[model samples]
Each structure stands twice: as structure tokens, then as C-alpha cells.
Target: MAKITGETRLENVLVYMANMGRELIVADRCTVWLIDEAKQEVYTTVAHGVREIRIPAGTGLVGHAIASGEPIIIEDAYLDPRHNPDNDRKTGYVSKSIITIPFRNNDGTVIGAYQAINKMTETAKFTSKDMELLSLAASYAGKSLESVMLHQEIVDTQREIIATMGEIGEMRSKETGNHVKRVAEYSYVLALALGLSPKEAELLRTVSPMHDIGKVGIPDAVLNKPGKLTDEEYEIIKSHTRIGRQLLKGSRRELLRAASIVAEQHHEKWDGGGYPNGLKGEEIHVYGRITAVADVFDALSAERVYKAAWPLERIERLFREERGKHFDPAVVDAFFAKLPQLLDIRERLTDKG
Candidate 1:
């Protein structure tokens, strides 16, 4: 389960399963092939040192095992009629003993196949014990795969919700969806470079877009003013910080709670000149600091109702000059360090409208 949830990528989960299968079964190599019934294909996500592979369902020993929902063991793979030597030929691997097991879901539907090849033994033949271990592991893999998929679906749904809400916040203020997109990208890179785990980085990326969620609470007169805001209107607009926090409060979901922190503190400055509580330096939450840099960068890059987009030269010089003044010095460094990726994200998610 740690292996499954620890990974953000599905292929990485399959890679973990295959590597564990090979080690547990004492085989030279292993492959984890997930079935796509609609496509009638068995796609290999990971194979011992190989990149990937795919074949039609019921094509080889592994495929047949999956199609029939059965397990197969071969003392000599080359002698087995169902064995497919094409993979070995391509990978320059010699076929020997093999075992293929079908991984069935809770409903007893075969979802995938696990194959271990060339058992490492004096006789180079797989033992019954080897088959049993692999079978048990394959079953666990199937259940873990199910859990991982469900987790992925939940995460995707959460992302969709955050994106939609962020878009609403931006659109209400006359900003484009690309504004939120750039913020997420910039936050994502800063998070990773700051040494957060992949899972944490991904979470920060998803929720960072919600930094301006409180904007939805600001009156359109203050939020969408084409001209400079009056002093009264400025104070009213700044209340978006507390408003966003209140809007996102009380959610048990980690994403929402994290988003609340960003929304509440994204306006805070490192020098204690920022609004809300005026959290300064490390006094501000790291999430807030990271999102602040991302928010400011993207805001300056894009044209806004308040002002035109700043020239890149001015933006870069300001980042350098404002280090530790407006933005966190470390975060600024990470921003420049990952500037290329940040630029790529800007280009990739450029606003069409």
C-alpha cells in the first residue's frame, strides 16, 4: 500500500509491483501487463529493464492466462507452445522457465497479468513454492491496483473542483484561466525545488490555484474596477484574504485546507509589509510563501485590469532586486533556477481567450 499511494504516476506503481514481483519470485525478470478490454490489448507498463511492451489479449502465455483467468507455469518456456519468444528476441533475452498469473479484481474479473521469467535456480526451473508466492503477490497487486486507481480518481476529481473554483475566482475578477494555470505551474516547480516530496509538490500545485478564491467574495465594483481603487475600495478588496479563508474553512479534505492557507496568506509579504496578519519571513507558512512567489510572477506576466503586463526584463530585475524584500529569497532562487520549466508551463497553458 505504501508503494501504491507513495507514487503519483500509475506507471510508477506498476514499476514497483513488477520489481517486487521479480525479487519475491527469484526470477530474472518480470512484467506487469494491465488489460484494456475495450481495446483488446494487454499493455505493459513496466518490464524488468525494458521500456514497455504491448500485445493483443490472449496472444501469449501471459495473455492467455489473463483471458482465461487462470495461472500457468512452464518448466521450460521455449518448449511451451503458448510462450511468445518475440519479446525475448527483441530484448536479447533467452527464454527458460516462466510463470504467468492472472490478477482478478474483487468481482473476480481478470484485470491484469503478472509474468515472471527464468527462475534463478540450479535447474533453472520454477518451483511450486515460487508459483504460490507470485500468485499471492499478484492478488495483492490486483487489490492495490484497484485502490491506486480509486485514489487517482479521487485526486482527479479534487483537481477538477479546485480548477473550476479557481477559474470562477479569476473570471469574477476578469482574469483568464491561464492565470490560475501559471500559478499552479510556478508553485509546483517551487515546491519540488524546495525539497518537498512529489506527492506534496503535486498537492501544492493543485491547490495553489485557489490562492485568489476569496476574490469571489469581493464586490465586482472593487474587484473589477477598470481604474485605480479608492482607499475604501482597496480595504474592501483586501478583505478577500479573510473571505477566501472563511470560504475554504471547515473542509476535512487536505486539498481544501491547504487551499485555505494559501488564500489566507498569499498576500502576506516577507518584509511584513503585506496584508492580513502581515506574516513576515519564516513567520509566514511555507505554502503561503511558495504561492506568493508563483502568484506575483504570473500576475506580472499577464495583463490585468489594474495594469498592463510587465516587461520580462523588468520582471526579472524586480525579482532580483526584491529578493528578501517582497518575495522569499530562497523561493526566488528556486523560481529563477526553474525558470525554463516555468516559461514552458506559461507557453503550454497560454490563454486562448
Candidate 2:
């Protein structure tokens, strides 16, 4: 499946469900809840006029339907035992009439619930026409949400696979740690700071780990040498940049294509002094430039077999010292500008190994 764009897809789905529910039924409040099967809960805020609220199956009007696999229409919420006024009190909404439906798939399995409360007509009681409109909307909501959720699941699966592959590469080189995760997050921050769009930034976050993927191709003797490598071994190590690019090259996927560029150019110095290609300054792609700063910063701050983590001051000094030569000056500035966030990420993702 193709990847979905932006962080707003889920949010947009919820908002649209809520809006449609309100417009079609002319209800004062419409609440859409996506089920959490493991937890046996349906929860949401989406035009519910409250902070996130979660209810268990068989608890309220909506909950009862979710549990019983049926729908309910109550002319007066207070008159019905199945109706729960707790949500009304919590949201400062007075629900007089309500229509709650269980959103089911083709096999009639309940995946979600939709409720429209307080019909706008002075009569207030929900009519047959109202129920018809609502049931149709509920059906559409279930199908629409299913599509969005599937897209989300696919995106999550792809990221996990990428993470596993990155870990394998790091493990092969004996640099076992949370290096990939940290670098991905750091690259995202740098990408955003460099003014890349959110979609591009997220793509960078997912694929940045592959920057060192070529290490898997290196021999153990050279990869895990205890000290400085001999000139030949060092040259061999430098070839990893080209190797990584070639490994990721020819992918039709955008994630792999961006990764290919980063893999090849991350080692290139801004001053035309790096290995493999010696690409200079702006000649290097922004993905490479952003990944370079993140890789170097994390590699320095992180613990290594041959060296311990650098002091924070030393790390700061190096960013300042290498601003234009080893790193792109603007990217370095962005790194320091967002240092607090970076430090927080490092703390949260600290290597347990």
C-alpha cells in the first residue's frame, strides 16, 4: 500500500465524521468513537464538547449497542435506563434526545460507535427520518475510518521494518544501541528546522537509520577493530557510503530513494574534503546535510566501545568548530537552535545496552 501523508489524516477523519454527524442529523453534539479492541473501549472528543472520554462496552446507550451489536433511539435520554448522563454533565451539555448506533463491518462486527445528541427541532424526539440519516452516516463513518486506520497500520508496519533493518546493520558493525531511533528523530528535527515540509521531514525520520546500513556489507575484522584502522581498512570503511547508496538505489519507493541520497552523501564534508565523492557545499542534498549533522552529533554524544560519550560542552564546541567545514553552517545553527528538544530526545531514547 502507498504511504499516507501528514500527521493530520487521523484528526481529519475524526473531524469529518463529527461534522457530518452534526450536519445530517442537526444534532447539538455528535461524538465518534474508534474502538480499542484490546482495551474493550470506545473513546474520542470529536465534537463531543469535552476532553477525551472513554467508555466501556455495555455501559451506556452507545456502549450497550457496542456490546449487544444493536442500535438504540431514546426519545428522552433521562427516561431511558441505557442512557448515561455522566457524559452530558462532564461536557456541560444537556442531552434530551439521542440516537446511538454501532458501526459494524460487513460481517456485522462492531468496530466503532456514533452518537448524535439533542436534535435541533423543538420536538426534540428523534423521528424515523432522523434514524435513517444517522444509520447511513454511521455506516459511512465505519467504512471511512476503516480505510484511514488501515493506512495508519501500513505506515506503522513499514517504520517497524525499517527500524529492524537498521538495527541489523548496527548490530553487524557491533555498534549495538538505540542509534537508529535517535538519529531518525534527530534528523526529523533538523529537517523541520531547515524548513522542509512536514511530509519530507517524516520521511527523513523513517529512512535516516539506513544511512549506516552499508556497514552490514563490511568484514567483521574491519568493522569491529578495537582501535584506529590502518589506511587500507579506513579506505574500505569509507566505501560503505557508496555501498549503502547502491543498496538502496533503484527503489520505486520515496522513502528508499531519499535514503539512497542520504546514505551516499551523509559523509561528504561541506568544504569538499570528504570521502567517496568529496561533494562540496550546496552540491550535497539537504537530506544528506541534515543527516550528517544528526549522525555526527549523536555518534559523538553516544557511548562507543573505543570511546565514552563526549561531555555536553565538548559536543557544543564541536558543533561550533565544525560549522562550515565538516557540517553545513545552517544545519549546525538549526541543531543548536533546537538543542533542548534534541537533548530531550536523547534522554528519552537513551541506549539501555
Q: Candidate 2: which stretches are off by over 4 Å? A: 1-8, 45-47, 67-70, 89-92, 105-109
Task: Report, for every candidate in turn, its global Cα lDDT versus the true structure.
Answer: 0.88, 0.84
Deviation (Å) of 287 in candidate 1? 1.3
Expressed as tens digits, the lDDT of each residue in 278-311 for candidate 1 is: 8899999899999998998888888877798888
Per-candidate clashes, comma-separated: 0, 0
lDDT at residue 52 of model 1 (Cα atoms): 72
Please give me the total number of clashing residue pairs in predicted model 2.
Answer: 0
Model 1 weakest 10-residue run by lDDT: 1-10
Mind giving the per-residue lDDT tens digits that candidate 2 earns over 1-353? 11212323767777777888888888888888767778877777475667788888568887787887777888888988877788678767778888888887656678878888889888877888888887887786676677677777877887787778788889987775488889999999999999999989999999898888898889989988879999999998998998998888997867779878988999999999986799999999999999999999889998776788999999999989998999999999999999999999999999876
Off by over 4 Å in 1: 1-13, 76-81, 84-86, 337-341
